[model samples]
Target: MAWIHLLIASIFEVVFALGTNATDGFTKFWPSVVTLVAAAAGVYFLSLALRTLDVSVGYTIWTGVGSVGTVTLGTIIFDEELNAGKVLAFVLIIGGVLGLKLADRKSGTTQPAEPEPAPVSV
Candidate 1:
């Protein structure tokens, strides 16, 4: 469930990023309005996941995934300039996100770790 919210947050980040790019320095009214709304939603869900997740870890994955998604979106949607360098950097970001997911699983953050029983004294 929390992971689902994280995914939602990532998608909202992409939407908000694209909205901002279209806003033209924030002077544009409608795009700016839309951007703000999307941004609010993005941050809200991000905060929701933080309830069960660590700040540094959650933020690392949330923002990393969002950043990579936004760039890929720009390339496909707006036909933006996507040179090899940019693609390589995006791939690195993706790899970093995957590594974090693996770490989360191993650390038992993705699932509740087993509880330790209290020791009995004689």
Candidate 2:
């Protein structure tokens, strides 16, 4: 599904981003190479997902997933920071994503619903 493809692309994006940070101003050869490979895969899969999903929705989903994943990974893996404010902000981001999914489901946006009756001819 498009969501799966988008999430896969997000993982690649996070990998590429982390690799880029490890490149040290492009002076590091191996890290740069990894960055390139991961970036290529990220773009390829993102494009594939766009084939079925609207660009706006696909882009937001991809960005949201990648951003959250990267930030969480940084904080947990590297112990960057996980203060109360930052944690609350992350919570808000998660809440926003949940709201989007729930709204889409409740609205039945995936498939058109029954049309309303035509106005009276009188």
Measured by lDDT, the strongest candidate is 1
Candidate 2 residues 1-122, lDDT tens each? 66688889999999887888889988999999999999999989998877766565667677777778888888866678778987887788778767765665576544433488999997
Error of 1 at 36 (Å): 0.4
Off by over 4 Å in 2: 103-122
TM-scores for every candidate against the unseen true structure: 0.82, 0.78
Give the TM-score comparing model 2 with the true structure, all chains together: 0.78
Please list the C-alpha lDDT of all candidates, in the order they appear.
0.84, 0.79
Clashes of each: 0, 0
Please report the candidate that would top TM-score against the real structure.
1
